[model samples]
Target chain A: MKPSSPLGARFRTAVLTLSLAVVATLGSVSRADVPVREEPQRPSAFGATEDAPLPTVAPGDLQGLLRNCDAERERAVAAQKLCEQDKTGVDFLGAAYAALWIILMAFFALVAIRQRRLSAELATLRERLARLGER
Target chain B: MSASSPDADLQPARPGVTWMPYVVAAALLVALFLVFFVAPRERTMGEVQRIFYFHVASAFAALIGWVGCAVASLAYLFLSARQGMEVIAKITDRLAHALGEIGVLFGTIVLITGPLWAKPVWKTYWTWEPRLVLMMLTQFLFIGYLVLRAYAKKDVAGRKLAAGIAVIGGPAVYLIHVAVELWGGNHPQVVSGQGGGLQHPDMQLTFAVAIASVLLFAASLVHLRMRHHAFTDELEDAYLELSDREDARS
Candidate 1:
């Protein structure tokens, strides 16, 4: 197995595995929930102060460009922030799905293996009967 | 398969001139060597890309196994119509089950090694990429196949039910390749993110060797399973022949 994954993968697995382990271990260790601090919500760009362009605009297409430059910059910044959030959201969901499956399957396999010998005995009896029918 | 007695010549790890599994083992070794020593390390992903050999190889091997199941299932359905069936029916049936099991086994390796390989590259266990989804679906269907095999009685109706499900196997294989292509179209910059239209020449060569070695391995598996099936069938035939002679004497 390749041990070192790329940055995006490391971030997701680390985040998810860490989150799951923390939740599982902490809840088992102590009853109290860790209080997560929330960041103050920033005002949307529509509510932000409008910044103006410098005084070097000529009478050509330059004047029109400068006029909406601040609004466009605000929109681009907002869009980029949304992209980062969307990326994280995708990682979160993917990690959760994978982790849940791995954890649950590992749990099931660990538990089921103990009963495998019983199943083998049943199989032997069935095989015996099939051989008996041939007689 | 040869003139020699199968009971003496055909068992795995037999002393002297047994070559099947050793050939398989040698092929695996060379495949591993080329992947590790010869193939240039990925500029972006480094050594972790080495897992690519086993991952893709197992995938192809699993495909071959699935195809065997599909063909055997089809033949079985047709043969059940005739009476006085020969060893072909029983042997094919046993082979179908063998290939199906091997498919699942290799698919498990692909799935497990996949996440490990993906982690270093995609930095995540999985994404909602169409390719990933189809692979999971394929694995689940194989699991269904195994379950059907496990429960089905050695009777007419049981075989029909298993055969019916096995019919869908072929289409599902086609869908997986198509799904990977379509998924790549939608998510251009995600996972493996290499260009060359997803078929880099170096990557293709490694994969080709991977396919070849894996096929050789699969052939070895099928041959061995066939031998086992045939030997056991021979013993049954021997017992029947003995009983017939006893009846004649009576």
Candidate 2:
């Protein structure tokens, strides 16, 4: 049989293409499987605009307005803190993933090295035995 | 013990090409992609929750591998008792050793990843959590098994001793599984009990993929390790035969 027959080459190309297509489909399917969580609506910080005209304040309304301003400031501070915590959490997650990959790869490399060394030793021993038999 | 013995040239040669490793690597890569890209970031724990996919999967693999080792060891002991040092018993012994070593490898990953995941979510690197302590003990037991096998005399006595230890330590896996429930720790039981575990479809899919990937990878490693051990045994037999023949000539 020819090593690189055109029929075999074509079959390999077709299989490769089919596999890529299947993988792409699986990726899309997984992405679509993500459940949409119903998050509670919050006021956006970016929604506050400088161009919006301020309403004329009466003497009684001025106190309520000042309280509202203080409340908004507190919410903004809380949001900032939450964002910082999320960032820190992401950083820790990244570090954990890095550590996992490094450890797994290191273990695999060690096993491969041991396997290679054993193979070489076995070969040498076999050669020695064969020479003894010849003698 | 002679060059002309029937068993002298009877050892099977290793295959020239093996595709299992490539399959395992590809599965792992797909699982990784699904974990990081497809799975949604958790609401409460944020990105840190993603670690659960691989962490839990590794733990499952390690636990299963150790249990497999124990079962194989028990089978070896049983066979040896009945058949008296047969080829099948030796094969089972080699299998037990391979599984034990693979268990240790994955168990080490679990120990490291567990701490890494814990530090971010639990706010501490190490906790004396019930499950954590039990897992550590189980890993230590298997590590001791591997150490004993490595340093012990290469004879039937050593094999029996190692097999005995494995049989004794096999129950630790069950204890580790229930430790959290019994002691009431923070470890979440996702796959068992009422309202257990993942709510999202993507999370479940990713976890399933991860578990399958690790299991297949562990199986491949065990297969390869067993082949190597078989080769080692064949070499030892050859050496013994050569030595015996030399003694006769001298």
Candidate 3:
């Protein structure tokens, strides 16, 4: 059987490349169709009138506020210690991702090794057949 | 034909390009970077939500492989039934087997990652959720097909039986997809329904890239596996011919 002319081969390659480009463009366009939904803003922690000017504090009131701050800091420290005791140090996210990549890489390595072994076996088989033929 | 038959060497085995594997490897590496670095972290789930990228992408790839296996199995069965194991039928058989194996590999990844993601979010390693159950069933069904292919005798009858199993197993994928809708479950509908799908554009972009990369990787695996299968078939044929010549000499 005769092979195709060089002109025909070039034309086929051109058509194949064009088709691939068109398909890629269409895929990207289709994926981009899903619009991202924007989230609504929540009110500030200071309340709705967060921009209002602060009222002047009495000297006596300031002293009380400082005492409250000291007590709150001591309580917060105790709460943090309790929380830390319950918290597990293991990072599940990192572990999950690591497990996934390990599985994939192992499979890839297995295939590569299998291919190499098969090629080597094939070479050995060919040599044995050649020796048999010589006899 | 005998071992010394000229036609054995006359058949051309097309040489595969050297660069295709490198291209796939690079694409997958880029996808990994995009998944970890580029995609926006979910507000509620935080860092653990990153698992969703590859988990969903692998599910997509596995589904594609199973569906491809079903189609190829049908083609092989139809062609072999009519034409008695012709080249096209044999090629389809090889494709079906390769796709089934690749699908199982990806499916195993899905099952493993599901539990890893679930343990932190759901406070348990496993659940009897509808989608989970259905996905498990689907994985088991195809796995049964693989077991049959591996353990069964190397003959047309074995191939036919395995092909039939693949045909029956293909619809399990559809059932798994609809299982969540059919029964109320704990599984999050991130890709469908109202309210809480992907909110960030970067998440969407990363998901797309991940899916494309996984699909490209799957295609490369199937191609390489098919080539391996073809070479094995050729080697087996050559061995049989040589054995026949030895017997004739004896």
Candidate 4:
């Protein structure tokens, strides 16, 4: 192509426009392929400067976080205490009922043993008396 | 068979009502069911309140035993001096002794169950409360009667003295019942007919069944003891007669 020809100049201009369009499309596709990361919003308690992120906790915020942690711990402890109380009540109830049954069974056993022994002794005495009568 | 014959005067009487044990067992099983499942958990005492059914039931059974003992004792004392009433008086004495022993057994159960219930509810096993003290005293009295009867000589005077002790202890049941009313105590008087009855029908039903079961059980035990006593007496008399005949022959 001639350096100053009108047709050559027109063809060069079209080629430059096509190259720019291809570059723009590739750039957009590459941008879409890469995931975008979103930064979390800082609380109002922190300073307003976005570039210089606060690296240390503020005094007031530290105390508030500690208080919240303490509250969570106390709630858990209270729940545990209630559970222990319920378990204790159940245990005592079982003990009381078991004691009653044991006492009753013991008494019944004593009576049964005594009655059996008495019957056996009576049988022996009757047998001996019958032999004596026969003699 | 002459009245003088050892078997004629001392034969054990057969029980007329034999179905009591079956009824008692059925009632007790129902009572256990109602107490554990049907009754509501108490507001403050929780599961410990279930003990109240049997505790009160045993107390009532003890009262029945003591009262029966007292009546039999009075009868024996009244009839022992009459002519040709020796056999009946002896029978009454045996009944009185049997009732006293069973009364002591029920009383022991009441004492044990009460302390067990109290421990969880009151945070202490025992305290010097009026109702508790009176109940303990009543228990001691019956225990004393049993000990005396066991150790005393087998004679009319000894029997009379033990019978007197029983008559005195019988009135203690009334005293124990009124002890809570007369003097304030921690014991709850739910079924006193005055006020503060059980709110739930299930609790009331369980209470009723427990009482019926304990009372019937006490009666059954008393009958067993009476029969045993009669047989023992008959055997002793037969041995004595046999010995006498051998002595005469020798």
Candidate number 2, chain A TM-score: 0.42
Enumerate residue pairs that collide in model 4. none
**C-alpha TM-scores of all predictions:** 0.55, 0.75, 0.73, 0.73
lDDT of 3 by residue, B1-250 (tens): 2445623452322337678788888988888898778885554444666788889999998898998998898898899988456889989988999999899889989989888877666666666667787777677767766666654424677678789989987788887787777886667777765555666677778888889988988898888788777876776677677777768776
Candidate 1 lDDT for residue B184: 54
DockQ versus reference, model 1: 0.03
| B1-250: candidate 4 lDDT, tens digit per residue | 2325443343334554778777778878888888888877654455667788888888888888898898999999999989999989999999999999898898888888887777665666665678887787777777767766654435566678779988998778788888877886777766677655776666777778888787877888898788877766666667767677668766
Comparing 1 and 3 on lDDT, the stronger one: 3
Cα error, candidate 2, residue B241 (Å): 1.1
Index of the highest-TM-score prediction: 2
Interface RMSD of 4: 35.7
Proportion of true contacts reproduced by candidate 2: 0.24
lDDT of 2 by residue, A1-135 (tens): 758644345435644654576578558756664433233221111111112233456777978688767767766676566466568777777877888789878977987786677667667766766766677
All candidates: DockQ: 0.03, 0.10, 0.09, 0.08
How displaced is residue A75 in candidate 1, in Å?
34
1 or 4, greater by DockQ: 4
Give one digit per residue, the lDDT tens place, for model 1 in A61-122: 76667766766787578656645544444454344335434743663374355235434533
Query: What shift in Å separates residue B181 of candidate 2 from its native position after superposition?
Result: 1.2
The Cα RMSD in angstroms, rounded to one decimal, for candidate 2 relative to the true structure is 17.3
- Compared with the true structure, model 3 gives a TM-score of 0.73
- Kindly list the per-residue Cα lDDT of model 4 for residues A21-66, writing each as its tens digit: 6577557656664333233211111111112222454677977677
Give the least accurate 10-residue stretch of model 2 chain B, judged by summed lDDT. B6-15
